[model samples]
Target: MWKSHPKALPYLFLSEMWERFGYYLMIGIFTLYLKDVEAGFAMTEKEASDLYGTFIALVFLTPFIGGLIADRYFGYKKSIVIGGLMMGAGYMLMGIHDKTMLYLAMTLVILGNGFFKPNISTLLGNFYNDDQYKDKKDEGYNIFYMGINVGAFICNFFGAALQILLGWQYAFMAAGIGMFIGVVVFLMGTKHYGDKTEKKGVQEGDMPFYKIVLFILLPSVIFGVIGWLIKGIQSDTNLDSYIFGSDSTDAFIFACIPVIFFYGSLYFKAKSEDKRPIGALLAIFAVVILFWAVFKLNGSALNTWADRYTDREITGTTQTVFNSLKLAKEIEYKKDSTELYDAGFRLQKENGAVKKVVDYPIYFRNVKEDKKPEEGSKISIWATNLSQSINPGWVIILTPLVVAFFTFLRSRKKEPSTPTKIAFGLLISALSVLVMVAAVQIGNNGTEKVSVWWLVANYGVITIGELFLSPMGLSVVSKLSPKNITSLMMGGWFLSTSIGNKMSGVLASLWDTYDNKANFFWVNFALLMFATLLMFALLKQLNKVMKEKGIN
Candidate 1:
């Protein structure tokens, strides 16, 4: 890979791989840690999902500012180093096991990701601007994306082992250690970047940093405050009590108003030659929000599905392997225990105090009577977080094939435009939801556990869609962005992702609301289909802009 590409490619790939390892590891067990009645915060599903959504949304949202700062003031390398250290520190702090510390750690990770994410991507894109590498940009991003999944794919196993062997704190600590290693790897490769890490500096008509803070950042904070304070219509179960679904959701949406306006202004105020590209990029950004909204469910709603609906039991060879690897734990059957759990722990009020009783694990609730172990017998089951690796595993397996398939088309002069790939990607992703709907039906609406293959099959289909859309999205932004605002444009791509991530959270929080789980998945399917239609409708215009820019 390095022979034909920039010497920096391997280093960047490894750095990104490690960074994602830390990130995905933390995320894999985040909600599970939150909802663990014995060792965690004991939050209900809604509370944990709401917080998970907000955490990830903010993580992506910061790139807008981080990218701008890097474009004008801090260079990419400096920003990345600063961000990496913050994230590493944050991950370590999470092991403190205090709510205050957890929030503080989350803040650090969120802000760190903002600075780290877009700048590294922009730095990689910069290398591809040369004529020799220009046509290879998409391929480079795909390889880089594979690196991301490599980290994502392997981290869950380590997480499972650590959490099972030591505790959640140890797993979290491992994430921090991984981040520190990534920073070290990144630093070692600084020499290869040369001048590519330099800042663009402020250009003519560019908003001054102070002015941006005054106009955009300040207003967003105020708008968020208003959204938090002002409640919406009252309803039973607190439905619609706050705008959107929760205070954080409402606040986040409101906060994005000024930022969204800022992006819009970019197109309107652009030089004539730049307007069409910016407009095209923005349109692509908007349509892909639905994709992220669904894809991000891997960490929230899908995690819940793996934990509750999927049959994770192992026996004989499989059980032996998992046990030897420390990836599975033994849960003893205790049929007479008074402890009960539905979505969360069952609580009883006694003398004005609530008590949580320990009983059988929730995993056996849907197991067939015949399949249940005899009393006092133990059954081995793999960690639920291990399911988080399925999508990335597919990405690792299929990326080269997808790249080769597209390359074959390129050889024939018949490869789809980036936008076309993205449109088809949305459609393909929509079909993946149908697999989940089928899973729900097959599992008999959670009355029985479904085969783990349902999750596997679902991830396999979506991974292909992801390959088509995600790397292509990154490549298109690099191809179409005006030279002065490349990082900013990359940030714009993440902005759509941030919004979609929050929306995923909002959707996941409502997991209990659907009596028929298939209906929930159907809603997801509809969102993606609508986005696909919208993208197809605008395809001609988008393609025209790409052609005008002299890019495929």
Candidate 2:
């Protein structure tokens, strides 16, 4: 892989690998940590999922500003370094365990990711811009994407071990260490970047930074404030009063209005020659929002499934190996000591206040009577966070095969356009939701635990969809964007992701309302199918734009 690619590819790959190691490690456990009764924030399922969604949405949102700043002033390398340090600090500070400190830490990670994520991707695209590597850009991005999954795949084991052996704080600290290591590795390869790191600076007809601040940023802030303050409808979950499902969701959606407008203006304001490609990019961005909306549920709803609905018990050799690695923990069966719940949760009065608490031993509630352990016996169960690795593990396994499949198609000049791949990706991802639907049926809608293989099968299918769409999205942005604002366009891609992520949260927050869990998966399936149809409808125009650009 290194021999065929630029010298800088290895450095970028390794730097990205470690960066994702930190990010994924933190994300894999974020909601679990929030919902943990003893060691975590003690938030309900709805609260944890909502906050997780908002946090990730903001993490992606800041890239819009970070990418613009890098394009005009700070340059890629400086922005990445600053962002990495901030993220590392944020991860470390999360170990302090105070709610205020957690919010402050989350803010740092959000802002830091904005600076680090888009710029690094833009820098890698820069290396492939030269004619010598131009034809290899898609392959280059696939290889780079594999590196990201490599990090995502391996981090969960580390997280599981740290959380089991030490605690949540130690696992968080490990994420900080991983980020710092990424920064050191990145600096080691600075000379390899050379002029690729240079800022593009302002170009003719470009909106000046101060004007953007005044027109876009200021309005976004004002809109967000209004969104937060204005009450919309009365609902069981909206006692605090919010337009959307939550205050954060309402604020985030409103804040995005100006940024969305700015991207729209780019198409209208573009040089006549640049108009079509910009429009095509924006259309693709809009369609893929649904893809992310469904795909990103791995962190919230799916995590909940793995934790409560999956059969995670291990015995014999498997249990022994996992125990030796500290990847599994023992839970004693003590019915008398556990609180009995009428449903999924119980309302308890504490200090004259009624609070709803998740039943921690809810895992055993659905087990077959014959399989239940004796009162004093213990069962070895794998860590729930390890389930987070399934998607990335599939990515690591399937990437080379997918690349080879595309390479074979390219050899015969039969490869589909990037837009087409994305369309199929949505279709395939929609199918993955059906697997969960089936699992719901087999598990009797959470009355019985289902086999873990169901989760594996679901991830295997979706990972293929992810491979088709995600890296290709990056490749398309790099290919279609006007040279001056490449990073800014990359930000647009993340902006779509931000919206989708928030949408995922909103959907996940409704999990409790669905008495039949299959309905939740069906809703997800409908969303992806709708996106797939829309993408297919626009294929001809998108392909025409690709042909106009003289590349695919």
Lowest summed lDDT across 10 adjacent residues in model 1 is found at: 336-345
Looking at model 2, which ten-residue stretch has the lowest summed lDDT? 336-345
Where model 2 places Cα greater than 4 Å from the true spot, the runs are: 130-136, 235-237, 270-273, 337-339, 342-360, 483-485
The residue pairs that clash in candidate 1, if any, are: none
lDDT by residue for model 1 (1-552), tens: 678888889888998999999999999999999988777888777888999999999998898888888878999999999998999999998878799999999999999998898888889989999899998877788788888999999999999999999999999999999998998999899889999999988888565789878877899999999988889988896776987888998899999998899889999989999999999999999999999999999999999999988898899999999999999999887663444555444455568776765433788888888888998899999999999999999988998899899889999999999999999999999999999999999989998999999999999999899988987888799799998777578778988999999988988999989999999999999999999999999999999999998888
| Highest TM-score model number | 1
Give per-residue lDDT, candidate 2, residue 13: 92
Error of 2 at 166 (Å): 1.0
What do the candidate models score in CA lDDT, each in turn? 0.90, 0.90
